[model samples]
Target: MDDTANDDLDVAAFTTAIEDFNRFYIRLPTLEKLPFTTLSVLDTLAYGDGPMRLTDLARTEQITQPGVTQLVTRLEREGLVERRPDPGDGRVVLVHITEAGRRICRSRHADRTGHLIPLVARLAPEERQAIAEALPALTRLAELGRDRGRAAR
Candidate 1:
């Protein structure tokens, strides 16, 4: 095969592998009853440097403003998040993740990692080493996709 053909095949295989891995990962049991969207929102807040505006959250999550408002309301009710007047801008409200939210995020991460540990342990040493070496590239790929998504929005 020509170089172009070889490259195309490699890209196709890589994409399929990623998709299959995602499908398998999603099937793993989760500790929380919260929907994926809710967990995602909580994770964003928990991992962010600080609180964020509703509009910013909406943009970041690629959801309608009204949808984010509703989601925030539910999260607030559950004591996972709180709204505070922005210190710099009194007119704006910032959404902050509570300790409870952070705890849940930590627990969920641990739960998923726990599930993956045994699966990963089953891999051959060389296979595990390959995955370890690929981490940086995988992370960069994720970052590129996320950046592209934001730019497209």
Candidate 2:
């Protein structure tokens, strides 16, 4: 195959790999408390990198601000997060996961991975290590694509 075609195949393969893995991720019973969409947003906010504006949260999720607001409102009621006036700009509030939020995130992530671990454990040890190593590369690949998307604008 030509180089370009091979590269396209690589992309397709990687996409398929992740989609397959995430299918397992989405199927975990730990997802019961929150839908995947809501869990995803919570995970993003829990990064502790810094507070993100509503618009930024929307952008991160590739969703609309109104959508993010509705999500935050729900999370807040669940005692998973709180909205606070932005330190940078009071008029623009940012979502901060509360202690409960942090606990839920930690617990849920653990539970989700617990579900995944048994499946991964079924693979041979070498295969498991290889999969573990590949995870970082896959994440970096995703970030690289996301960066390219921003630069394209």
Please give the TM-score that candidate 1 achieves against the real structure.
Answer: 0.82
Question: Per-residue CA lDDT of candidate 2, range 1-153, in tens?
Answer: 343576545766666877997887777787447777787777777863456677777877888878988988998898988889988777888788788877878988789778877888799999988888878977887688757755543
lDDT of the structure predicted as candidate 2? 0.77
- 83 Cα displacement, candidate 1 (Å): 1.0
Error of 2 at 32 (Å): 4.7
Residue 60 lDDT in candidate 1: 81
Winner by TM-score: 1
Mind giving the per-residue lDDT tens digits that candidate 1 earns over 1-153? 333566535776787999999898866787876787898899888875469889888988878999999999999999999999999999999999999999999988888899999999999999999999999989998788767755654
TM-score of each: 0.82, 0.79
Compute the lDDT of residue 51 as modeled in candidate 1.
90
Q: Which stretches of candidate 2 lie over 4 Å from their true place?
A: 1-9, 142-153
